[model samples]
Target: MSKINKKSMGQFFTPPQIADRLVQLLEQQVGFALDLGCGRGQLGKSILKRFPLARYVGIEKDREHFNHCANLLTEQTIICADVLEEKALSLISDFMPVDTVVGNPPFLEIPISNHLVLEVKDAIPNFLSSGYKMRSEMLFFAKSLKQLKLGGQASFILPKTFFISEQYRYFREHIIDNFSNISLFELPSRIFSGAEVSTCILYFNYRKTKNQQLTLGCIDANGDIENYLKIDSAAAVTRMDFSYHRLMSESGIRIEESETIGSIGGLIHRGNMSRNELVRKSVPHFHTTSFPINEIEISLDDDVKDGIRFGQEGDILLARVGTRCLDRQVLVTAGKRAITDCIYTIKLPEADIDTVIASLSSKYGKLWRQINAKGSCAKYLTKESLLNMPLFN
Candidate 1:
């Protein structure tokens, strides 16, 4: 596959060491093992290597990977299909009550309109609304869990968002409510070649327990777990990443939150237009670059703004998306420029503006964002996430 194609599809074939880690996490030795987004078949190969008698199926969306995996795992059934599709999930009937599920789902953003998501909308709850879409890996994880039988076990090599991001709180809560024996194994950020994505292995048995203790481990380059800890599942519900938990404790950072950003009169608005819209309407438009912003007085076309507030003095311009720049913020200077879509514009009380910005840049703010920010590399913070973030006293 071309580098561009692989990048576009977010395909990072699993390394053999990671495959061993995934296999190690699963407890069941046989019967109905399912691999979703089974890129290049490394995981399936590992599973079958350990459980030779197990019935295994590897599903891959990329035909190239599918063919490669098919050839690689000749003993297992390899199917080329979009795992997120409803048709793909309908196969739960054919392979109902899987004993173990494993895969390294592609890291990509997909719309919520996937037939399966629409079908299960009422059954499953996602925090993202229509405008914001679903993460493909999360969807894959959810679907796999749906097919897992009672007493089944699952272990997937998932991106960091699955462990740390607040956007998927529902998934974390689901794990606590419906599963036990949860263990999260953090992997290196550079685990995948040419990708800087942070990842972890999520292991759980699909059974409930009260006050379950969850294990947090880290696997070094040799695939041997080098560091480990145990904590109550409830304690890690808000932020599951061990690094975050460990850092918070080690640094001795004390944080106190008395209110949310929204409660403090920090009204959030997302930009709602593009360069094309700007060309047609001739309105002042600003992307994330329009900075050193002095007292600005540019606002989107009323219809263009779609009732969203933008472009005013004392407003906070926040970089809404980017792995590196996402946490950046700039005080609106005395000038004229307005942001339309993706980026955020917050209109706050004149008195509260400086304090809010300062608090956001403080140690407490960084700590909150480290866990609350969404996405893997290019982080995304939704308006709701921002508004609901605790404002430290």
Candidate 2:
């Protein structure tokens, strides 16, 4: 009955409406269902209502939630253990050939525990072979795929970033290549009340076939299912395809293969100056808030020369911290300036800087950046991601 600490357990219980919607997307008859990270059985409850006689198994790591599920859902089998353990796959497979795997897996990055990481690495070697770190939800997706029968299906509520993030490109490739009937249901508005990140429900079958077409769907604010867009599986694995899908779904914009800022001789890199060293030098430096940077004073000492990011006139400064700040574009002019690491100093001549700023500040440019930016509370862009952004001719 106590409030669950979502941060510690990474547990975000699905709302009743969202749970019911996910259940409705499943095939009419499900012989057996596995709830991978069932919080307090909301999703299980919904599934049972839809398929009254379906055999259900719910896994929960937190004792409080496990006990709650046990007390509330007496008819279903609930287990208490970390789902990422080595024995979990075999234990679930003992039930053999699960028809449906459903639940919103935890999304936070697991704490730095070597044993847990190794267990996951051993269990899902192919998913982790990209050398990019794995998230708990990514592991669950792989585990769910492994647990299903050839024709079984999986419906998971996942962060929107899972589809397009550079770090998850390998995982996306795996899903595109190994799964069929790959459908994405994007909910632009926040479904989970307190969760900051936007979410989408992904439904796909375990069957792998070449040249499968992906179905994309969206739920408007009124909960109406919009028309679906079919994309070729070959294109689905590319970054631009994902970006185009999101833009079309959310904003009705279609992006074509075009020249990017990086191609135009513009270099986007993080400000490498140390804040502490800036203060020690007692120089008048520009932070992200110091906009329209015209004049600034600095010591030419060896420490300052070696430590701070010195910017010349005609450079563009972008705030990389919060969403509001990220939208603000500052043009460096008049005098040399030392910028703090909180900002990203773009090195380009005045003409290119002006063009890039005008494009990035435009509607489509902002949309592109928003699609690529990552983070929950304060979204931000990495240097590579920024440089890779499409630049309109």
What residue pairs are clashing in model 2?
Answer: none
The sequence of per-residue lDDT tens digits that candidate 1 reaches over residues 198-299 is: 789999888889898888878987788988888788767786877766655554543343566788788887777764676577766666665444422333
The global C-alpha lDDT for each of the candidates, from Candidate 1 onward, is 0.73, 0.71
Top-lDDT structure, candidate number: 1
TM-score of 1: 0.67
CA error at residue 62 for candidate 1, angstroms: 2.2
How much is the lDDT of residue 206 in candidate 2? 79
Q: Model 2 Cα displacement at 304 (Å)? A: 10
CA RMSD of all predictions: 6.6, 4.9
**TM-score, predicted candidate 2 vs. hidden true structure:** 0.81
